[model samples]
Target chain A: MLLLQSALVQSALVQAALGALPAARPTWNLALPGQLLGALGPDLLLAGGAVLLLLVAVARPESDRHQRAVGWASLGLVGLTIVAVVAYASRGALATEGPIAVDTFRWAVDIVVLIGTGCTIALSMESNPLDGILTAESHVLVLFSAAGMLLLAAARDLILVFLGIELMSVAVYILSGLDRRSERSAEAALKYFLLGAFSTGFLLYGIALVYGATGSTNLATIGEHVARYSLMYNPMLVAGVALLLIGFSFKVAAVPFHMWAPDVYEGAPTPITAFMAAAVKVAAFAAFLRIWLDAFPTVAYQWHNAIWLLAVLTMLVGNVVALRQRNLKRMLAYSSIAHAGYLLVTVVVANSLGASAFLFYLVAYTLATMGAFAVVIALGEPGERNQEIADYAGLWTVEPWLAAAMAVFMMALLGFPIAGGMGFFAKWYVIDAAIHAPHPQTVLAVILVLASVISCGYYLGVVLTMFMKPRPANAPAVRPVPTGTFLVIYLSAFTLLLFGVLPNGFVQLAHDSVPISMVGAPARAPVASAASR
Target chain B: MYPLFYSFCFYLFGLIAIASALAFVTRRSPVAAALWLVNVLFCLAALYVMLDAPFIAAVQVLVYAGAIMVVFLFVVMLLNLGLPGELADARGLLAKILAGLAGIVLLAKIMSSRTAVPIESLMLRPDSLATVARIQGAVAPVAQPLFTEYLIAFEVTSILLLVAAVGAVLIGRRRAAAVEGVGAG
Candidate 1:
């Protein structure tokens, strides 16, 4: 009896010990927001939209009948999210404690990304290869990629940046090869995957080096350490910064590292290419600007010239190579690279105006590219790739609306004035910032203007081919208008022109949306506290 | 001596990796390229071990070398690419020129990069066995935070992967059926 009692006591003690040990940390409760209402607002909405899409795909697996409905609903949801993001921005209610800041800066990019995603979804619904892949995956990947882009634009740490880049890239790599029937598509996916993995290696190693030099992956902490200790000359840190630049430049399709751009753009579904050229480019450049501006502003003297030289090479190479391209998508791919050069000029200035210019240019770029892709999707027939310049000859005759939309895209891309649209203002802002920079950034500005001039060659080539070139005697005529694709084309064109003409309102919002709370808070407060002093 | 050891190990692995990477790209035989890529991955694993990221090093070898490379080999063989003419057609002139240019540029960049300083001095409280242990303990919380903060994202990623897997299977199955029909016809 006594032995049994002792055993019971021992068992009780063991139970107590087990209970005291931290419960295997719950996965779903770690960093969830406190207030239930705010907790799942945006995330829940995004999830709900995804679930609805999944349900739609499952309900009608083989039929393409209600595809137009899916496109319309997706666009409406995306538009709603843009409004929600704007509301969040205005209320200043985006709360977070991690390396990602959820603020107005993020909101602006989110709006642009969502719009780009909406256009891609619309195009995908119309005339992709549709190789037994669910439309849900397409729309879901677009949403997820946009979310990742938002996170990337708001990242304040190396870890967050890497995570965001991987998230966006993995989805895109898969999206590029969606139409597995096409050898070109598969080849494009393989090339992008290999190159992306290679660039990731550089980014990861650079992060390790940066962490080693500063003993932190947090951007603000690194900046503070570098400022106080003057370790800009540290070889490891310098190498890390340079490698990081290369990795991000690759993501943005900058020169030299942009080898994958033309092939991938030509090979992928037209909409995905448009999303990549517009939204993904914006997100990458935003993150790139934020990282450098926050962590390496003091070390600008060291790496400034490297970036300048890269900007010059990127502009020259992108524009010159584009002039020789016969493929429309490949030409746009190079044109996007040239735009990256213009954005890099803003980074060269490394100031508030530079930040504003990036945001403004993103709107114009997104609208124009999405509009262009929409037109391409609308005009293209099955098995008849509209990528070749000759394929678009006399488009003005059959599809005058599409030809007009394409003209808008080409003119905006060339940065032509007033009638050409707000793209001119976007270019002017970037140039002005570069010229007025505290540093010697005017050189980048000059190169940027020259590059824009070079861009006119290909842009006009497309316009001339569509308008002036006569049609073949017995070319296949356009069939009845497809409802879904026509919607995408008209909407994209409307947005492009609307923003171009009255860009001031959007430009102001972007300027005010800068994520200054983290880095510039101290500078903003007029009176320094005793602690600060 | 410790710094020299680190430098030597980094260079040794780096050279093996670079050579294997070149082999992977240049080899005409897809099977041979896959093997060389495995070698490159193995070298990278060793370098990770020397850098004190033993867990990551293990994951790299296990996931990349073991799983990914095996899948790559399967796909290459399944495609039945034994035609001599087919193999020869793969290496175009443009590819050769681009590869050469890329290789030279990469080599120049690597050579020009300044030597990185050793990191021991900057380690918070000077890294020790105890510090590593502490970090390992903290990893649970770090992981916890990631899950909580990104629960939707994590779940979505799982779903995405599942969909992709099923999609790939569906595509392969459909293609197989179409081939059967053609053969019967």
Candidate 2:
């Protein structure tokens, strides 16, 4: 009789617990959302492809042939992803709000990141064997990192953003140290890992503090709360925003936080360096814009001064320091920092026009930078030797085509009008956006022009060195450029020139790619204007 | 009345945890510091048990307080570190002052925030969590959220972990091979 009573009480407890569980949770539901594919198709495809490639890598031992095959396969996968992104982008954004984005902006970033990934794979395929890195796993790491980048482009919530950052960072960290024989590569990896982890800590703490202040991590929801409550000056929110700005500064390699870029870029393999400078920068900037525009529009005023200061410091420091770098790789690293400053100008605008301008500038920047890195690989010998600025002193004498192509890349980076081609229009639109902002950043526009002039000291220095200086008496013979790398360089230069002459269509596409939800977020206007975001 | 006892135990354990953490930092010997860390972890586990999360408490004791602490002790012994005076510590006056200032400021902020921003309305309200915990047992409280609304993040975390593990193995093996080659030569 006592045993039966105990059993009855246990059953009663179980039923009571089950009954209260539903009432205790008022807002949350366990049912899956209605739609998923239109937003997440490309990311899922990329992840699937990467996992399969990783398995393939596990099956094969490290070999030059295996590496090449993996490289080609990675490029093909990136191509398919680009096709999916373009198709879905035309279909418009998903109607429902979720953790991941599926807008034209996200798709545009996807295409740009994939372009960089494809080129990096081609370049690495040519250079890896020469460097004696036979691991097919390196290609798999690149694919994994690219998938992470795609996720970053689509992240709509803070937690997703953190995961995306980690996924991208872990893969890139290994890729940087793939040439393990070199002590410099190991040092680069360790420094990058330690410092990157530290920055991630700052990012997480900021997210936590923001969550504490407003009780939401969803960007759209946070924006609504901030607008409705007027939490702009709330001390906690301000501190969270400040920390977030600092964290992103580290990620994007802005001045005062870019101590790692030069050493790591120089020590890393050239292909990985290009990936860092192009795709990594693009992804970080895209996420930065997304978070700032979508989540913190009410408190956006808090960051304008801070961003303006960073932009000025980054531009001045990056260009002035680049003039002193003799190593081509380090110089390009610092140049990327300067470009980061230019990108920050667009963030300052924080309007539809600015995002549109950012898309165009980023595309042009990627093309020019990738073409330049390809040329760097073509000219560099094995073991990363002979990459000094003077090494290409008389490239026009032995290899006129390579020298001319190099000049085109340099001029484009310098933003020279006709010579720079697409680069000129890219810079013009950024300045146009800055000046036409609700409150004009006229001083910033002028500073940008001055920084470009300062950058000419190095960009033109490369061009003049190639055209005017004589080749050394015992210079090494020019290498035969790989067909894949040659194609990358040719396409980039051709597109830059072609678009420089006629930029109407590209401009329209850039304009169209601006996030529709962010269209009303001009300066001094509350982003609450975009309903149903 | 039972809930009051739970809060009393929480405060007691929290105080012990804080004191031990301070001692852990200040301890001269590495082993002593690690032992203090174990003490703190135990207090945390006991506090977890008071909340009726015996599974979490057991796991915390097993994984962190026991296993990870043993590793720490092993590393401390293996390194054979020197005297306490030689061990790295915050020696500079400026650093000391700055650290103290930061701590004081943080304390001030928390104290001031007590009235202005109570903890209840903030992101991690304990009331709702307690009810959920009663229904879900020890791990379910965490796993419920992880597998449900944040399912994608949870799945992607596995990919991140796999990538990290593979990278470590690949890098470690290459290093070992190079060292072996050197030894053979």
Candidate number with greatest lDDT: 2
Runs of candidate 1 exceeding 4 Å displacement: A1-44, A55-60, A66-73, A94-97, A129-136, A517-533, B1-185
DockQ of 1: 0.10
Output per-candidate TM-scores for chain A, rounded to 2 decimals: 0.86, 0.91
Clashing residue pairs for model 2: none
Model 2, A368-435: lDDT tens digits are 99999999999998888879999989999899988888888888888889888889988988888898
Model 1 over residues A1-533: C-alpha lDDT tens digits?
77445544643442232212232321222134554235235544654675576567546644455555665677777777766665555455444334555555666677777778877887787766334333445665676676667667667778767877877787788778776456787788778888888898889898999899999887777888998988899999999988898898889888878999889988887788888898888888888888887788788778887888878888999999999998778888888898888888877877766777777788888888887777776666664265578888898988888888889878877888764576776787777667766775666777888888888899988999999999777666766656766776676666556556655445555555565443233222101111253
lDDT of 1 by residue, B1-185 (tens): 38998898899999999999999887877888889999999999999778667666888999999999887877677678633345767788998899899989998877766575547776657365436545775355446745875544455466456545644654455466557767999
Candidate models: Cα lDDT each: 0.72, 0.84
Best by DockQ: 2
Question: What C-alpha RMSD separates each model from the true structure?
Answer: 15.2, 13.6
Q: List where candidate 2 sits over 4 angstroms from the true fold.
A: A1-34, A519-533, B1-27, B55-84, B88-127, B135-141, B183-185
Query: Which ten contiguous residues of candidate 1 chain A have the minimum total lDDT?
Result: A522-531
Model 1 C-alpha RMSD vs. true structure (Å) is 15.2
Cα lDDT, model 2, residue B164: 95
- The stretch of ten residues in a row with the least summed lDDT in candidate 2 chain A is A524-533
